[model samples]
Target: MESFFEFRHVYKGFDGRAILHDVSFDVRAGETVCIMGRSGVGKSVTLKLIMGFLKPDSGQIIADGIDVPLLSEAELTQMHKKITMVFQSGALFDSLTVFDNVAFPLREREHENEAEVETVVTGLLSMLDLNDQRGDYPASLSTGMKRAVAIARALAARPKAILYDEPTTMVDPMMSHTIADLIQRVKRQYKLTSIVVTHDTSLARKLADRLIMLHEGGVRFFGTVEEMDASQDPVVREFLQQDELALP
Candidate 1:
């Protein structure tokens, strides 16, 4: 199958310090791939590059047949219609209510009339179990709720692919499980091509069709979750060990 997204020999750096070195991977359509790594290991950077938020120092980043790094500002905006990132911070509009926050994308991107937007956004909020919070603002919601709103907003855009950055961080285990299940449900429901950047092995295990472990600025391991578990590579083993300790 043709790759829906790809990073071919991707190299990125800041101030002469390399962050991603010759990183290469392909995510086929409808497949979920988890990019696992410790903090500051370019997990989020990969998403930024994919989103055209940052340019690669060298190498190609392709999504949906467009060369991401080469897209112009206008072109990038158009490309964004097919891909959306759910930020770790749940970057919702502080001033907008949950319903409006979720509707913003449809209003802005899809230019859906208010009635149509309301129909879609209301269904999303109801489906996601945020109906009670629809009138609430972001500041009043819990971290998990904020993240759910962010997911709703992403879904409003009707993206073919979604990038999740450190999705379960700073939340309690119950909330993490809730968010994980949400991700799983959305992916299965939409048949989305997904890239989840996380260090949470449990989340990775639950969500990934394949896993890529990033270490020291490169892909240290890339294979199925079962292969990852059975690997003898010291680096991969170290991550697994840390993951074991992280579990309750």
Candidate 2:
């Protein structure tokens, strides 16, 4: 199997404060890896780096055999289509209706016809059980529905990989699990490469094929769920314990 994404000896910082130090990892096609950490431990930064929102201070990031740091403007445009991000806040436009929100990306590219757009966007919205809310604006939706709309919008581009940042945060208990299940089904059904960044181990356990934990500006552990459970390291144990308490 080919590696779809690789972070090699990456070091990054802002204003003399380092967020990542020599971090290295590779995500293969169709792989789902969870990057978990305590709050403010650079979990979101990791997602941003993969999305090319921030340049690393040093080292290399390779996605689909293209060097991210060396990519020209044209190359960056192609890379943008290969990956998409699901933000923590859902980031919907209060002004746009849900259907239009999902169709926004398509409209920007000017390639999809109304029928084509409706077919694809409606399918996505229906998958997340938001078909009836197509005309509803973000202001009318609940937190979970807003997230579902955001997720549908992200998938509108048919990206090869998705960077989900704190996908299940700040939702009801039932909705959280429902979203987790939706994520699992979506990945398998679409054969996607997913990198979910969150400290929520319960969600991680349900979705991750491999698990990685970051602490103190480095990857403290990278392994399977069984290995995580068996880990006797104080930090790993503590993190998992906290996760257990977080479950509904």
Candidate 3:
């Protein structure tokens, strides 16, 4: 598969401290790559750079054929149509019902056909097991349900690529499994290029075709799960050991 998202020696910083330095990785088309690391290792920053929410001080962030950092505001808007990010917070509009929230992107495209929007929204909601909550507001939903709704909203845009930021954090084990399963279902059904930033080892093992382990603003390991398991690097071993210890 061709590279859908490429980060080449990317650098970004806040204040005088660098959060990412010489970071690089490529997510292939139709492949799922998970970004993993301890807190403040620039895991989420990489996703923002891809979305042009934050600009790198130097280096290239190529999404599809466009160099993300160099795009004009108008150009970035167009690019955003083909790519979407599912934020960790779920970021739903409290005023919009589940149906409307999932339908928001389709409506923004000026479809004019309400029936089409209804069909798409209903299908996504049912697929994500949100059919029962379609009329509910964000305030009423649990954390996992909100994330599922957010994923539904992201898929509603029909993006070529999807970025997920910490999909299973703060949820109970059952809900965490549900979110992971929903993500895997989306991957198999949509065949989208996916980049997931998560610290959950089980989630990573389940969804990642490859894993990028970041540390101290750089990539410490980048390879398949088996390779990661076989890795001799002390950092990788220690991370795995610690994650295992934290599991319930």
Best prediction by TM-score: 3
Residue-by-residue lDDT tens digits, candidate 3, 1-248 = 68999999999999989999999889999999999999989988899999999999999999998899999999898888899999999999999999999999999997448999999999999999999999999999999999999999999999999999999999889999999999999999999999999999999999999999999989999999999999999999999999999977
Tens-digit per-residue lDDT, 93-160, candidate 1? 99999999999888885557889988999999987889999999999999998999999999999999
Query: lDDT values of the candidates?
Result: 0.93, 0.88, 0.95
* Candidate 1 Cα errors over 4 Å, as ranges: 109-111
- Using TM-score as the yardstick, the better of models 1 and 2 is 1
| TM-score-superior candidate, 2 or 3 | 3
What is the RMSD, in Å, between candidate 3 and the native fold over all Cα? Answer: 0.7
Instruction: Give lDDT: candidate 1, residue 6.
Output: 94
Instruction: Give the TM-scores of the predictions, in the order they appear.
Output: 0.98, 0.96, 0.99
Candidate 2 regions with alpha-carbon error over 4 angstroms: none
Candidate 1 lDDT at 227 equals: 99
Tens digits of per-residue lDDT, candidate 2, 99-163, equal 99999988878767899988999899889888899999899888988888888898988989888
Whole-model alpha-carbon lDDT for candidate 2 = 0.88
| Candidate 3 weakest lDDT stretch, 10 residues | 104-113
Supply the global lDDT for candidate 1.
0.93
RMSD for each model, in Å, please? 1.0, 1.3, 0.7
Q: Which portions of model 3 miss their true places by more than 4 Å?
A: none
